[model samples]
Target: MDITGAAAVVTGGASGIGAATVRMLAARGAKVVVADLNEAAGVALAREVGGSFVKVDVTSTEDLVAAVDEAESLGPVRVLVNSAGIGWAQRTVGRDGRYASAADLDAFKRVVAINLVGTYDAIRLAATAMSRTEPLDTGERGAIVNLSSVAAFDGQIGQAAYSASKGGVVGMTLPVARDLAAIGVRVNTVAPGLVDTPIYGEGEASEAFKANLAQGVLFPKRLGGPSEIASMIVEAVTNSYLNAETIRVDGGIRMQPK
Candidate 1:
């Protein structure tokens, strides 16, 4: 919907793609709330953008609900970007030199809990608040943009847990859109491939790693930037007709099998 004067909440707004979206949203005149576990970065970004910051753990119902309430105080939450997530690179079968063993259950569960289930938790609650909101001019209540990864489609050698967690986000997009269609709320996902987020390294990725990730990219021949993904998210939220879809922001790269 209209970004101007709209209240928006962005989980994982401390840095990376979430931070980029928050900046873009603020520039468009949306009243934003930075929701993330990183207090210093979140608060600093909020200050820079003239928005509020809420320390949130996506897995906590209370935290997610509280963020929704915080945004409501600014205005009806008309824009939501669920960008909070954790990543792991663990093979399903562990190596013990002579033999392989099953993966660690806790590691797998942790990834799913935050990246998958946590997304659902935030969306379910935020949509509840959005449902009560009066529809905008285009009959839109709000829009939700969830983050997934290209790994969901083509995971690397040790990314089983990460892939499964993100794949769930991709899987639920259509159903979520259908479920919220009656309320005029749209749901969509963006699965980015090999983004240059902090996850890779603080500044520049190693030459070898960058080359490896960029192997199949058609033109750019480099890692996608956070701003690129953020732009897609903002565009999706503003465009009322786009719904129940997962857009791949990869540079035409189908990740190679590891």
Candidate 2:
């Protein structure tokens, strides 16, 4: 897919990987819409990249539609990066009164809603919009990139909800790609491992916890940077043959079970 001069929409484009992707798409000459819940950051980033910002809550179908409409107003939404999501860590069941059954279930639903369902919404609507677009010389009308997590595969003890939501993302990639194939649209996912995103804010995760997390990385013993993950997203959009694949950008780090 040729992104230059294309209309692109990135959800969660206010921070972390989403923010990085917004910049990447803008730098590649794509007209970008930064959609996120954080108005200040979203608007600021849009200003930075000379793109537009749409305040959105991924769980809202209306918000998603509005975002798509905005992107189409710029032009057909040819590139969509579904990065708006939430994370939660709690075991499905626990001993010593550790488990909160109802709370856990609620958390699970919320995670899946935002990560899996939200991503699907973006892909479906964006593809529909892009369907109106004539295919380029490369036979591609659009590309969709969704974010997963290494936890989808390397799920830790307390990451049931997070992992399941992300796993749903990984599970749907191929089918979604096949569905969009005939329309000259592509869908893929990026499952990042231990990356230095805002999942742990400053002075949030303990120093020891951080060290332990990085210790598991097989090499380059550190967390991944947003730019590193963003680069792969750029590739997923630009590299024509790459579809329905969940590429792991972990540093050979197969996580340890807790």
Candidate 3:
């Protein structure tokens, strides 16, 4: 689908891969909305791209609705990127040698709620808005790109919650795409491997740690960049033929069990 002059909403757009996506979309002439929780960063990024910023908590329907509305105000709502998510590391059972202790149920629930449920919430709302728009010459009203992780497939130890949440995204792509076909809305997913994002702290220690992580990559011997993932997302959105597919941007790395 052509992105020029289309309104695009990208959650978690203040930083990381989402930020890169926001920049790329704006560069392509899409009127982008940087939806994120970080007001300071979101505002800065929005200003940088000459787009709007809406503070959003993905779990809240009201917040998402406002974001979609904001996007529509810009022009035809044609793109939605669900990139807000969190990670947790814990075994099903306690790892501190405590017998019968289980992982923090609340943490597990939070991760799934934000990563899985929140994503669906955005998709539903955005697609609804897109359905109201006239289809392009290509007969496509819009496209959605969801952010998953390689962990969804090769989950490591202590990644049960994160994996389950992302795996849910991969699982729903086909069904969601099918459901939205009547409206000419397509859905796809991007499962990225390790990328240099703020989740890792800054400074020498962080660089050293990231280097060790990069050693596992199959080629180039480096961690993926946020722009790399964003490029794939743009492709997924613009390539009308790409639907119900999950593309991995990892450099041929299968994670090991931690």
Candidate 4:
């Protein structure tokens, strides 16, 4: 599970948590492949890390397949990070008189497809490629770290779709880990609390929201840093004993209805 000189693929590597992960992996001597929908950002990030970029839409199987191929060509892909996901904040029925119609259902489906199905697709494809590689000293052929959210367990009022998708991810971790056991590949997830990622506004969150989030945190009464999540990911990958688990990197803050 040592990432040193290993080839790693990180989806949604253009910005936010994904970008932080890309940098962390690269710093650890992993030859990373940045897979993202943003071509320019992906390329720029890859260049900064001295890695490679593969433009990919995680919702498309073809795009994911191609990304895997490109990563494999670089070297053995021993690490896979699923960080690409979309968050939606619409109630099933809005007070503004917007009913949850066919279009709303379709939009929800799209979110699920991108966040859950897409993550599964990338994991399966990347794991298949990793299985073909020889095992390392730790008897580990590869490791996959999936990104989930605290909302999976503690959803806010308007986060139905986003929470459902993330909940699915949390549910899948154990079984996928069991399935990949024989191949020496480990699967795990990280459910983060409110982090200062782009998912929250570009800058700091609104004062009221920030205060609310920090209400019950044990320490650091503020949003988490992207590097904090990245650190856990690196640890999970490097520690072969860790598998089939979803660790919460939140500051002990379980969100509630505002």
Q: Which candidate's lDDT is highest?
A: 3
Per-model TM against the reference = 0.95, 0.94, 0.98, 0.93
Residue lDDT tens for model 4, 1-258: 677888899999889889999999999999999999999999999999989999999999899988889888878899999999988887677565645432378778988999999999999999999999989977899999999999999888878889999999999999999999989999999998878765445334565666666766767888888999989988888888999999999988867674
Best by TM-score: 3
The candidate 3 region of ten consecutive residues with least summed lDDT is: 93-102
What's model 1's TM-score? 0.95
Q: Kindly list the per-residue Cα lDDT of model 3 for residues 60-111, writing each as its tens digit.
A: 9999999999999999999999999999998898756776588888999999
Better of 3 and 4 by lDDT: 3
Candidate 2's residue-wise lDDT over 1-258, tens digit each?
A: 678888999999999999999999999999899999999999999999988999999889899889889898887678999988888877666565655543467778899899999999888888999999989998899999999999999899888888989999999999999999999998999999888875666674555667778988998898889999999999999999998899999989998887
Q: How much is the lDDT of residue 156 in candidate 3?
A: 98
Per-residue lDDT of 1-258 in model 1, one digit per residue for the tens? 787888899999989999999999999999899999999999999999999999999989999988999999998788889999988876666567434477777889999999999999999998999998889878899999999999999998888899999999999999999999999999999999878875666434466677776877987998889999999999999998899999999988888877
Q: What is the C-alpha local distance difference test score of each model?
A: 0.91, 0.89, 0.96, 0.89
Residue 96 C-alpha lDDT in model 1: 73
Could you tell me the C-alpha RMSD of candidate 4 in Å? 2.1
| Candidate with more favorable, higher TM-score: 1 or 4 | 1
Q: Candidate 3 versus the native: TM-score?
A: 0.98
